[model samples]
Target chain A: MRSMYKSSLIACIVLISVLASYSFAMAAKKVELVVWDLQGYSDQQWYKNANKAFMEKHPNIKLEFEPHEGVPARPKFISAVRTGNAPDVGILNLYWVKDFAMNGWIQPLDPLIEPETRADFFDGFLDYASYDGKLYGLFTETGVATVLYRKDLFAEAGINPPKLLEAWDFEEFAEAAKKLTKDVDGDGKIDIWGIGISGSRTGGGGPTTFTQFPFFWALGGELIDEDGWPAFNSEAGLASLQLYHDLVYKHGVSPRESYSYTWDDIARGFSAGQYAMALLHNTHAPNMDKQFPGQVGAMLYPVPEHGITSATTAGGWIYSILTDDPAKQQAAWEYVSWMLSPEVMKSMCADIGGLPTRRSVFDDTMFASDWNQVFGRQLEGAHMKPGDPIFPLIQDEFAVAIQEVMMNQKDPATALDDAERNVVQRAKATDILK
Target chain B: MERKSGSLKQGWPYILMILPTFLLLGLVTFYPALYNIWLSFRNESLRTTVSSFVGLANYRRVLSDPFFWGALGRTVIYMIASLVLRVVLGLALALVLNIPQRGRSVARTAILLPWVLSEIIVTAMWLWILDHRTGLLNGLLATVKLGPYGWLVYPGMAMGTIVMVSLWKNLAFSFLLLFAALQQIPLDLYDSGKIDGCSSGGLIRYITLPLIRPTVTIVTIMVSISAFGQFSLVYSLTGGGPLRSTELVGLYMYQQAFNFLDIGYGAAIAMVIFLINIALSLVYYYALRSESLY
Candidate 1:
C-alpha cells in the first residue's frame, strides 16, 4: 500500500510540471501586429516615441507599420479590406467611419473600450466615431475651419482683424475682402487677392466641403433630412451658395481662379502673399505664425445676417482595429489606447498642430497659448460631418453646386436644385434612400 | 495515315511547352475581361453588402446620363488631337534625326528622356511649371512683365494645357517607333531616289512614306488606344475639372468605380469604351489598308 501511494504522488507532480512549462512557452511567444498609418504621421517624433514606449511595455507583441501617403491610401485601404489582407489596425478619416462600419470592414470598439476611457474623449468626437449606436473607432485629433488672414495686410488696409472667436457678418467680411484686394505694383492688375477658397473637386470633394461647409452651417443648412434624403437645396443652401458667388463675381474680392483652388493651392497662395485671407483649417495657424511671425491671425468663419450662429466644420482622423482575430484585436486596442492616453495625446497634438480629441489634453499648458486658445474655442461650436455612408456623395454634389455658381454656369438656386437632384438619384441608386 | 500520326506525335512536345504561357495569359488577361463583362450586367456596389443581377440597368443609366456623353465627346477630342500632334511632331523629329549630324546620338537620348520618366514625376514637374501663382513658367513670364495666365484654372485653357503636356510626355514614343522604321528603309532606295533627281520633299513623299506605311499604321493604332484611355496625367493635373472640362471618359469611369463605388456602372462604361475602341481600330485599319493599296 505504501509503494502504490508514492507512485500516485509522483504521477501528479509530473503532470503539474508539464502544464506549467507549456503555459510559460505560450506566454513567451511573440505576436506580430500590423499597423497602417498616414505617411507623415508615422514620422512625427511623438508618434515614434509612443510606439517605442508601447513596444517596450508589451514585450510579447511586435509592431510592423506600413505608412501610406495622400489620396490613394483610401482606395488602397478599401481594396485591402475587400481582399482580406488589411492591416490589424488603420487610421481613417472620421467621415469614413460610418461607411466602413456599415460594410463590416471594421470591428466595433465597444467590447474593447472601457466606459471611463470612452467618456474621456470630447463629446462629439465619439459620436463621429460611432455608427448605429456602436463606437467603431477613436478620433485622435480634430481640426476646425477658420479664416487664416494676414495681419499685416489687414493693418495696411486699415482694417482690424476680427478678434478671436469674434466673427464678422457676411457684409462686413465682404467689405474687408474688398478693402484688402489691391494691385501692389500698380500694373493695371490685381497682384493681391482678398480671400481664397478651395473650389476643387479633389479628395472626392473633401477639401471644398471642409472649407466651405461653415458658410452653409452658419446659415442653418442641413445636408440631409432624417430619412437620409437631400435637403441642402433650401433657402439656407441658396444663401450660402450666393455668398460664395458674390465674393468672387459681384464683390470682385476673390479671384475667378478661385474656382480651381484646392486646399494646397489656398495654403500656397496665402503663404506666397497672393491672398490676404484664406479659408483654411485651424491646423495651419501654427505654421502660418512660424512662417510669417506676428503677420497672421485666426477668426471664426463669417455668418449671414440672419444666421443661427457662427459655426464651423470639424474633421479629423480616427484609429480603428480592422482585424477579426481576438488576440490581434486586443493588441491593437492596447496600441490605440496608449496613443490616446493624455500624455501621448497632448504631445502629439502639440507637436502636430492638431486639436486633441480628448478633453483632458485641452487642459495642458501647451494648448493654452493664444492661437491654440482660438482654435480650442472654435472647437466648442464646431460640427462634425454627418456619419452617413451617403455623405461623400452629398459632398461631391455640393462641390459641384459651388463650382457651378462660382463659374456662372447656373444661378445659386438652380445649381442647388441640380445638385439636390443628382444626390437623390445617387442615394437611390446605392439603395441608401430606399 | 501513319505519316500524319507520326507528325502529331512530333508536335506534342511543342504544344506542351507553350501550354503554360497560354494558361497564364488566360488567367491574367482573359479572366479579368470576362469578369468585368459579367460585372457590368449586375448591380454591384461597394456601399452595399448585397449584389444582384440588374440586366441593362447600368447600361441604360450610363446611356441616359449627360455626363457620360460629355465625357465621351471630350475623350474623342483628346484622343484625336493627341494622336495627330504625336504623329506629325514625331515624324518631323525622326526625319531631322535621320540625317548624319554631329551629336545625333545625344539628341536621340535626350528625346527619349520624357518617355522614360514616370508618369507621376512628369505630372508633378508640369504641375509646378504651370502653376498659376508660383509656377516656373509664370515666374519666367513675370520677369518679362507678361501677365500671369491661368493655365489650369480657366476651363477654356485647361484642356489645351493638358493636351500640350500629354504631347510632351508621349512624343518620344512615336519618335522612337518612326525612327526605327526609318532605319529599316533600305538606303539603296533613298540613293536610287536621289539618283532619279527627286528633291528632299519628293523623296520623303514617295519613298520614305510608302516604306513606313505599316509602322505608321501600327503607331497610329497604339497611340490612339493609349490616348483614348489616358487617365493619370489629367487626373493628377485637374481631376477632370475646373468644371469637368477635362473629364475624359476614362476619368469619368474611374470616378464612378473608385470614388463613388458604383462598380457596375463603371464596368458598363468600360464595356462601352471597349466597343468604341474596337470601332476606332477597325476604321484605322481599313483606312490605312486602302492607302496601302494606293
Candidate 2:
C-alpha cells in the first residue's frame, strides 16, 4: 500500500509540473501588432525610432510593418478592412475615411478618444477625423498647401519671395515668376523655369486636388455648393483657369512640362535647380530642405489683391485601429494613444517637416527654429476637402478640366463648363445628387 | 450519338484530370467576366455592400455621354496607329534581319530584346528620355541649338509619343512572326522567279507576297487585337494625358470603376469594351479567312 501511494504521488507531481510549465509558456507568448503607411518610408528615422522605443518598452509584443503608395494603396486598404485582415493600426488618408466609415469596415473612435485628448488637436484637424457625428481617427500631422521658393534664386533675380505677413497677390506672384525665369546658359531656350505645378496624377486638382484647388479657392472659386452639387463653373473659376493659361502660353514662366510631372517629380525637379519656385506643401518642405540645405522658402499661396482668400488644404494623415476583436482593438488603442502623445507627435512632425496637428506640439523647441512660423500662420484658415462621398468624382472632373486648360485644348470657360456638366450628369446617376 | 456518349463515359477520367484547370479558368476568367456583366446592370456605390438591379441605366448613361464617344474614338485611333507602325517598322526590321549577311543571327536575337523588357521599366526609361526639363531629346536638340520640344505636354505630341512608345514595345512580336513567315517561303519558288528573269522587287511581289499572305493576315489581326486592348502602355506613358489625349477606353473604365468608385458603371463600360472586342475579332476572322498559315 505504501509503494502504491508513492507511485501516485510521483504521477501527481509530474502532472503539476507540466501544468506549471504550460502556464509559464502561455504568459511568455508574444502579442503581435501591425502598422502600414507610405509617407514614413521616404524619411523613416521618425517611425524607426518610435517603433524601436515601443518595442523596447513592450518586449512581449511584435509589430509588423507594411507600406505602399500611389493610388492603388486605397483599394488595398479597403480590401484589408473588408477581409478583417487589416493591421492593428494604420495611417489612413482622410479621403478614404468616409467610405471606410460608411461600409462599417471601421469603428468610430469616440470611445477611445476622450474630450480632453480630442481638444489637444486643432478644430480643423479634429473635424477631419469626425464623420457623421463620431470621431473615427486621430490626426497626426498638419497638411496644407504653400509656396516654396529658392531664396538664393530670388535674390539673384532681385525679386523678393512672398512673406507670411505681406503675401504676394496674383499679379505680384506672376511678375516674380517672370523675373526669376532665366536662360542662365545664354541659350535661347529657358534653362530654369520660374514656377512649377503638377498637372498630372500627382497634383493639379484631380487626384491630388488640394495642390491645385487652393489656387482656384484663393481666387474665390468654390468647387461645390453646400448641397454638394457642382458649383465651379463661375466667373471666378474661369478667371482662375485663365490665369493658369496665361502663365503657360502667354507668360511662359511656368513650365509646359509641369503637365507631365508627378507629385514626386515636382519636388525632385525643384531640388535639381530646374525651377525657381514650386506650389507644394509643408509635407514636402523637409525633404526639400534635406536635398538642398537652406534653399527652401515658404509663404502662403498667392492670393488675389481684392478678396484675399485664406483657404488652404488642412488634409493630414490619421492613425486608427482596424481590428474587430475587442481585445486586439484595446491593445491597438494603446499603441495609437502612445503615438498620439505630444512628444511622439512633435518628433514625427519634425522629422516629416510638416505642420503639427496638435496645439501643444507647436511649443516644441524644434518648431521655434523651423519654417513652422509661416506654415502655422497658414493653418489658421486651412480646411479639409468636403467630406462628400462623390468628392473623388468631383476632383477627377475638375482635374480633367484643369488639364485641358493648361494644355490649351480648351479655354478656361469651355473646360470648367464641360467639367461642371460632367460632374452633375454623373452625380444624377448615384446618391450624390441629393 | 451512342458512340459519342460511350466516348464521353470512357473519357470521364481525362475530364476529371483536367477539372482543376477548368475550375481555375472558370474562377479567374469566366466568373469575373460574368460578374462584371451582372454589375453592369446594378447600382453599386461605396456607401452600401448590397447592390440593386437597375437595368440598362448604366448603359444609357454611357451612351448619352459625349466623352465616352470621344474616348472610344481615341481608342480606335490609337489602336490603328499602333497597328500600322508595328507592321511597317516590324516588316522592315524582319526583312533586314532575313538578309544573308554577317551577324544576321546576332541581329535577329537582338530584335527580341525590347519585347522581353518589363513594361514599367520601358515606361520609366522613356519618361526620363523625354522629360521636358532634363530630357535626352532636348539635350540632343540643344546640340543643334533647336527647340526643347515638350514631347508629352502638348496634346498632339503626347498622342504621337504614346504611339511611338507602343510601336517600340510591340515591334518584336511583329518582327518574329514576319521573320518566321519569310523563312518558310520555299526557295524553289524564288528560283523559278529568278529563272524567269524577275527583279528582286518582282520576286517579292510574285512569290514572297503571295506565299506569305496567310501569315501576314494572321500577324496583322493578332497585333491589331492586342493593340485594341492596350492599357499598360498608356497608363504608364502619359496617364491618358495632357488631358485625355491618350485616355484609352481601358484607362477610362479603370478610372470610373476603381478610382472614381463607380464600379457598376465601370463594369458596364467593361462589357461594352468586351462586346467591341468580340465584334472586332469577328470582323478580322471574316476579313482574313484563309487556309492554315503555319
The numbered model that scores best in DockQ is 1
Task: Kindly provide the TM-score obtained by chain B of candidate 2 when compared with the true chain B.
Answer: 0.90
Inter-residue clash pairs, candidate 2 = none
Scored against the true structure, residue B235 in model 2 reaches a CA lDDT of: 83
Please report, as a residue range, the 10-residue window in candidate 1 chain B with the lowest summed lDDT. B285-294
The sequence of per-residue lDDT tens digits that candidate 2 reaches over residues B1-294 is 999999999999999999999999999999998988998999985455677999999999889877778889999998888878888788788878878999998887777787899999999999888887678898899789876788877777888888888887778998899889899878898888899999999987777766767777777788877876788888877777767788888888887777766788899988888888778878877776755433
Show the lowest summed lDDT stretch of 10 residues, model 2 chain B.
B285-294
The model with the greatest TM-score is: 1
Candidate 1 Cα errors over 4 Å, as ranges: A1-8, A306-308, B1-27, B143-145, B290-294
Candidate 1 per-residue lDDT, tens place, B1-294, comes to 999999989999998999999999999999999999999999988766578999999999889888899999999999989999999999999999999899999999988899899999999999999998889999999899895888988999999999999998889999999999999988998899899999999999999988888888888999999998999988999999987899999999998898878888899999999988889888888877634424
The regions of model 2 sitting more than 4 angstroms off are A1-36, A39-43, A59-66, A80-88, A163-165, A185-187, A201-204, A249-252, A256-261, A290-292, A306-309, B1-19, B196-198, B291-294
DockQ of 1: 0.61
**Model 1: clashing residue pairs?**
none
